[model samples]
Target chain A: MRKMTKIDIITRPGKLEELKEAMYAIGVTGMTVSQVFGCGLQKGHTEVYRGQEYAINLLPKIKIEIVVCEVPVEAVLEAAKKACRTGKIGDGKIFVYPIENAIRIRTGEEGDIAIMDPEDVEK
Target chain B: MRKMTKIDIITRPGKLEELKEAMYAIGVTGMTVSQVFGCGLQKGHTEVYRGQEYAINLLPKIKIEIVVCEVPVEAVLEAAKKACRTGKIGDGKIFVYPIENAIRIRTGEEGDIAIMDPEDVEK
Candidate 1:
């Protein structure tokens, strides 16, 4: 069984394209991206709209998920941070998880093979 | 330190509301949901538009993530499976990961407290 690590990155939605490009440049292409709402240290700020104050608890964010096997986790982490950094609060966070197994529904491929590209199968 | 577990469920987008209701009934709230694209056994299908064939390799998927400490992992897992099950291909998958710690940005609350609601603080 191959040891697989899953990285879930929650960051500003604007940084998604750059992150994608950076990951692609690093030869780590497979990923699942999603739009999410969360509250961090920045939590929610009060907004005065038409003379009324409203508190927004959940903030909009983007989440990038990448499950890697052969690729170096450190490299991916660095690339992700560099791409998403804005030097401000609510920039987002990254969570690492241990994946027990992965299966490609189409091919019924399990473990790391389910995550690799067809071209990279030879590698 | 509280023992925290993160459950990531990939299921049909339509089933999200029901799953949420089920979890809420089980006293397991606080989740992050996202729209993700993936290829499972259902992968992608060929569509013919204007007599042109287009192969879609990735399918739309909804990912629901919940991090809990006091809630029994077994109960959450069962609730999720029961709500998301359709006994069909591309129904989705569930993943469990051990969480080291969680901090609520607004209150600086850490561990399980960060995950609990303010009303539940006394409990």
Candidate 2:
């Protein structure tokens, strides 16, 4: 069985479109995208709600998760960094974890095969 | 020193409310919730858009991510499975990953401490 790695990229929400394009360019066809609130080193900012100042620790962010077997992890990291970087504190972070298995619900395809695009399988 | 594991639960969106209640009942406080698309063996379903039938391979899913140390991993899994299972297809999947470290952005806390609730810390 091939080793599978799951990469979680939590970054600015505005970067989603650009990030998707970058991932596509790198042959990452399958990914999970979600909106998330990230509480990080930036310490967050204050917002005025109902004329009252409120310190919001959780800032809105976008998290893109991809489980990869065919694409090198480094390539995905590099592409993501270049696409999302703004040289700022809230630029976000990337996390890498080991995935023991991935199963397709409908077909029960597991591991690398579960995540591979059909075209890639044909190729 | 503690073991931190990240559990990613991707399941039916309808189960979110029940799942959250289950997690909270188990002392889970912090979790990142996001909307995602899952493409698996289910093969997807077709829908009519603008009088044209489109084969939508990707299905909407809710992905809840939690990094835990104080709460037992088994407990979380059990709660999730119970809340999500419907004895049918598209019930979703549960993925476990080893987390090397976790950091709290505001205080830069690490490991198990990063994920602990303030009230828990006091107790």
Candidate 3:
């Protein structure tokens, strides 16, 4: 019955590795990363190919999602912000949510156990 | 203030279009799609490339995220589930979270307004 919070970090794709390393350093091993398209203050850019102009409305971004119960939410937020900081408009955004449950299909683990590394499980 | 809920659906990439159409039919337009990698009961596969064997433990997944305040959470959930249903192990998973707030960077709108379509905005 541990409480869990899910952190969604959307930022420049190039900064993913830095954020990953930072989170991992804090023992937050399990995460889901995705390539996304978003429109922020930076909006998008226009490109021409084969003499045809195309407007790309959504800019490319990366989303790192992690659900944790033991890790402090503030610590993870700081780590993500530190890694993603660029003092630019399109540095991206972070969203925090309260997760009700998590289930691991392989092992049928639930809650906090579902997101933990196998090594952390009892051998 | 309106209570907002964010739904995160992780499923096969191919099902994205179907889900989008379904949600749109229900007037759920604002969403974020991401290309992600995950491992469930499927557990990925092994491939041979140029006389080398590569084991991909994580399979490709598409995560569709939508934050809504007006749409009924159950309706959106049912639509996503119906569209993503395959009766297969990897058909996907749905994670729902409570969202505190949403902001639109372009106009500095917040809360429910941030998620509304411009067409839905007043003249």
Candidate 4:
């Protein structure tokens, strides 16, 4: 483990199981989330009023990634800020980074206790 | 382009379109967000309280990731900060990393200019 700390999260799209149980109750594990489309202009990308070329829509979003090791990275950003809140306007965004390596692709174990668990990252 | 940066986002379940538009408006692309299950305590990991290892109800979640040139990292963060927010619970997170390289599958480009779009990544 050279030094690691990565916590990137996007929100909405139904809360992703309450922010993955609030980042696995603060202990974190392997993580990666996908499914996105957020090309700005405040959600107004498709337009062609005169001749008609409209139909861009594009907005749905969900992106989560966690690669811990930097001593829990502040408890996974305080349990993902209490599981990606909700008081208005989409509600999502947390970032922290400083990772040089993390490998466990079925057994390439490397760094920070080989990313925890798995029998202590293979004995 | 041998150096880059990475951002990862995770949150909610019902908000993809919004994220996409938001990111693009801010100028970013080629991100990944996938469905996931999170394990932890506060959410209560499945238990065999007594004689049975009860159901392991993993909380659902999503993960998103972005790798942009170092130049646009701050802008991306600012836009994301504004876009992903609610204010009560589960307020997702974001993290950035220094990338060593990024490649465009369509072309044989590697590093910075490779990830912007099909337009710049080509020879």
Best by DockQ: 2
Please identify model 3 stretches exceeding 4 Å from their true place: A42-57, B1-34, B39-59, B64-123
Could you tell me the fnat of model 3?
0.25
The TM-score, computed over Cα atoms with residue i paired to residue i, of candidate 3 is 0.55
Selected candidate, larger lDDT, 1 vs 4:
1
Q: What is candidate 2's CAPRI-style docking category based on DockQ? A: incorrect
Off by over 4 Å in 4: A1-3, A6-123, B39-57, B120-123
lDDT, candidate 3, residue A100? 72
Cα lDDT of candidate 1 equals 0.72
lDDT of 3 by residue, B1-123 (tens): 799988887877889889989999998967898778753311243433345644432467788888888888778877877787765445555666787898889999998988888778754
Ranking by DockQ, best first? 2, 3, 1, 4
Q: Write the per-residue lDDT of candidate 1 for residues A15-120, one digit (tens) a residue.
A: 8778877877766736677778875432465533345654653667778888788888898999998998877665678998787655543344556776665446
TM for chain B in all models? 0.85, 0.85, 0.83, 0.74
Clashing pairs for model 3 are: none
lDDT of 2 by residue, B31-120 (tens): 998778654421243533234654533567888988889999878877887788775556666666787898889888888888888677
> Model 3 residue B58 lDDT?
47
The DockQ of each candidate is 0.14, 0.20, 0.17, 0.06
Q: What is candidate 4's lDDT per residue for B82-113, written digit by digit as tens?
A: 56655422334454557777776776777777
- Please, what is the TM-score per model? 0.55, 0.57, 0.55, 0.47
| Model 1 stretches astray by more than 4 angstroms | A7-31, A35-64, A68-97, A100-123, B41-56
Output the TM-score of candidate 4: 0.47
Q: Chain A alone, model 3, TM-score?
A: 0.83
lDDT scores in order = 0.72, 0.75, 0.73, 0.59
